[model samples]
Target: MFSKLVNPKSIAVIGASHNPAKIGYVVLKNLVSHNFKGDVYPVNPKGGEILGYRVYKNVEDLPEVDLAVITLPAELTLKVFEDTAKKAKFIIPIAGGFGETGKKGKEMEKYILEKAREHNARIVGPNTVGIYIPSTGVNTALVVPERSRFPGDGDIAFITQSGALGLLTMDSVSLYNVGFSAFINLGNRVDVNENELLEYFGKDEKSKVIIMYIESFKDGKEFMKIASQVTRKKPVVVLKAGRTSRGGKAASLHTGALGGNDAVADGAFKQVGVIRAYDEVELVDYARALAYGKPIMGDRIAVVTSAGGVGVVTTDYIESKEHGIGMKMASLDEKTKRKIKDEVVPFASVENPIDMTAQASDDDYDGVLEALQSDPNVDAILVYALFQTPLISEKLVDIITKWHRKGSKPLIVGSIGSNFTMKMAAKFEENKVPVYMSIERAVKAIKVLRIRGKYIERWENE
Candidate 1:
């Protein structure tokens, strides 16, 4: 159903414009700038040429377009949609004066949906920023290319109900070198909704993790049903807004729908094995860890750190179940302890959170991680790689990355400092090794991995 929308061979920008201020111009520019590997058709009544692509005089004059982006006013958008519906398989109307506006707007939205059904066509939104696929270079998002950055092609597929938030996230996450397979903004959700997209991405081979930011669901039961099936195959993480009555009222104003009961939603999510995130950071952090790190089969974690203070805090977070992230510190194997002791100074602590002291070198990490990986008690490893230490160089990034790729156990790294620490953390993340700036966040990521592992265990047993 989403093949045309996801990988259209031909696309038409119905309201293509020469004016840089208009969204039509930016939408067309994004497609052209990305060098989309498909035929691009630009349509406008006053068309001459836009960014070198010949603009068609009208939608009626264009050939069969797999996707049509209508960037006009609500009334004109309906007219343009009627024309494009005759030939286009999918349409994305990037106008906001729809159901969210009031009575008249809701009627207009109903008309568009009715016509869409008759033509056997699907609509992404009457109010939306649209979609972006890095692999195909198809960017329909109405954001300036220079200012709003985009992620490279990677595993996570992000779906958001809010266009601005979705774009902001894509831009922000790019700074960490976290890439995406695709981005979809389900603006207004006129025809397509989150449940359908969840199932779609679940079967998508390119999408290793599916993350969503939603305020309301079109069908709560349907979403739970889809999520249950999807989670069995690939992890699904959702950051649901509107947990309070005041928030629900705000959500209704924003999306033209009442927010579902958060208490019931929470139960449904947990029962379906859907991982829940409360904030934007947790959403991305959870998805990134699930996409790159292995599922933590057991709760035992072996923490290797250069800084003693970091190790201590990490232990506190792991040992405490206050926030439901209770994980055990791995009981170091006798041989593992011996190897760690040999690698570091005699004064170094050889316990669960092996504090190699500030004097520990990169080689010490390499040896300690290797030993921990072979330890039967260690189901996961968290490294406190403080880069400021004189002995720990940039080489530790590669050392951690190597152990991560081995896939013996899930590996997570936590580092907190200034620019130097952040730079090293970014490097580790770029290598597909999960890195968090705080010990708490890193522990939370491990908690997500454990959630995934438990789901897999339950599914297999069934």
Candidate 2:
């Protein structure tokens, strides 16, 4: 299923249009602009021409097409699918009236499914944004048509049920410079669900991490079966919606989704070793951290920082009453503590959360990081600084690069100032160190990393 969708040699766009604002036009534009290495036929009855390419009146008119993208209206979409079945083996229905709309829409969806089964055709969506494969330069997203040109190539495959949310999440995470192997928006998933994608990504050598934003699950037992197997091989992070009573009700009305009991899903996810995220922000947070951050061997976290307040906040969250993890603060040894006191100002605190004070120099920063990196008690280290301090930024980059070269443990940075922080954030990213704007985010990243490590440890023991 994935091979045909990802490696189509020829494709046809139904309901092709000339107007750039329409979804049909943007879909065609993205495919053409991204240099898709295949033949593209635009199908439209009223179309004279589009983007200098000749348009065929219908799918029957096209000579050969392996995949067909249907962008026609809901009422007329079935006819298009019937016509496309004769020529194409795969169909991506981008129209939005199926199951999401009410009773009539459900009937239409049933009809579409019957037609697809009759012709042995596979459908991607009836209400989906589409798919993107950066390596092959094939983008089928309706929103953000220009994202096809964005130089994104990484080992994470993301699948989301919400089309708009999926694209927005991609754009948001791309700001941190993380690339994706593939992005799939599975709207009103009539046939393809999270389990199939999970299995595919598990076997895909190009994918190292799998991230999903799911509103509901069709087959709970099947999802757990595949998710357990996949997480044992690679990390799987999920942001499950329809948790709250109100949200669950909204989910049912939104996509006719069956919102299962939140407690059951929670226990199921945990039993299968699936890392569940509380929100969308945490989903991406865990994705970036697990995708790039190194593994944590223990739960002893040491924080080194120039800002005392931020360090205190991070420590509070790391040991918060809400977190159930059994991580403890690893105190520095007497010798290391003594060295910090002797090498630095008398005002600096030499505790687990080392506050270097504002007067600390670049040498002081490097010294603290090196001490933490060498400390046997420290399983992971978090560094906090304001990006306006150029010396601190440069020193951080140098120290991180050096430690990374020496096989350092997970080192997380919490930067201040939105603008300057973004600049240094890119530097941390280049050095393979995850950076967070908030202390809470740093703690959450570490928490998920710890969870993944625990899961891996269990699997290895088994």
Candidate 3:
């Protein structure tokens, strides 16, 4: 099923056209632009030719097609599917107004399902953006931009219920120069749902982290079962929508999904060791961190900062004990405290949330980082603002880059100002250190990494 759907050697766009703004046209353009290595045929009743390729009147006229992408209207979608089923083994329907609408939609969905069974074919979505397989260079999305290229091969595989939202997230990650293994938009999931996809990606060698944006669940028990087993092996981060009653109802109409009890879903995810993201930005943050950063071993965090307020905020979040098992600020041992006092100025406070004060120099920052990194109790270290001044920022970047190259523990940085901070951020990114704009984001990222790391350890041991 996966090979025929994702690695197909030949494909047909059922509603292909020459109009650049049309969905079919964009799909064709994306394929050609991305240099997809496959036989592509355009099939449309009104089509003559598109992008120098001859267009067939219907799918039946195509010589050979392993996969068919239907970009026609709701009324004509089933007929297109039936025609394509004769030659293709997999069909991706990108139209709306299916089971998501109401009774009429359900009837329409039933017709498609019945026909698919008779033809021994599988359907991706009745309402979906489409799919992207980077390794195979197969892009089935109808809304892909003309300039869109296949994202680089990475360990993260993204699956989302909202087609547009999935594409937006993919674009955002690409801007950060992050790539993905594959992306699946499961809009109004009729034949293929989240559980099936999760199971598939769990065993996929190319996928190390699985990210999902879900509006509803079809089988809560089954989803929890698979999610628990999969997350034990790899990190699974979910951004679950429809928390409120109104939102749940809207979600149902949007994807023909059962939003179910929000609280129950939350508990289920937790029980299965899944990390739930509160918002879209956090979802990407968690996904990216898991993809790039090493997993944190414990919750005992040490804050080494030149910005006292930022250090305080980091302490507040780490000590709040709000996340999974609630992390705490590890106390500095007497030896480490003495080292900080000896290395730092007399006025500096030598505590767990060590405030090096504004007078901290390059040597002071290095001393504090070295002290924290050497401490046995400190599982993770948060470095805040070594670049308060121009001279200091440059020196701080040098120090951080050197230490980061040799560091084993997870080190996060929070910049104080925009201009200097941005440069420091780029350096830290180059050095492969994850930097955050706020202490809250840093703490959240740490929490997720720790939880996922524990799950991986347990799974490996089992």
Among these predictions, the greatest TM-score belongs to 1
Model 2, 99-204: lDDT tens digits are: 9999998888888777778888877887987788887867878776455234377777888999887777777766767678888888888777778888998899
TM-score of 3: 0.83
Residues 1-462 of candidate 3 have per-residue lDDT tens digits of: 476777788889888878888888888887786678888999888868898788988777797677888888889887677767777788888999898889999999988888888888788888998898877777877654644434566677888999888887767555434567788888888888889899999998888789899988878799899998898777889999986454534664834355435877787887898988977778877876776677888878888876677777777788775532378888877878887788655567788688767777887778777776678887877777656543364778777656655776677666656765766665665555666666777788888788777876766677
- Once fitted onto the true fold, the runs of candidate 1 whose alpha carbons sit more than 4 angstroms away are 244-261, 343-345
Q: Candidate 2: lDDT over CA atoms?
A: 0.79
User: Which candidate number maximizes lDDT?
Assistant: 1
Determine which window of 10 residues in candidate 1 has minimal summed lDDT.
Answer: 252-261
Tens digits of lDDT, candidate 1, 1-462: 687888899999999999999998999988988879899999999878899989899988999989999989898997877778888888999999999999999999999898888898899987899999988888889887778788888899999999898888888877777889889999999898888999999999999999999998889899989999999889999999976444534565744344435777788898999999998889989998999999999989999898888888888899887853778999998988887777545667898789888879898888888888789999999988788878889999999899999859899888788888878877887898889988889999999999999989988899
Say which prediction, candidate 2 or candidate 3, comes out ahead on TM-score: 2
lDDT of each: 0.88, 0.79, 0.77
Better of 1 and 3 by lDDT: 1
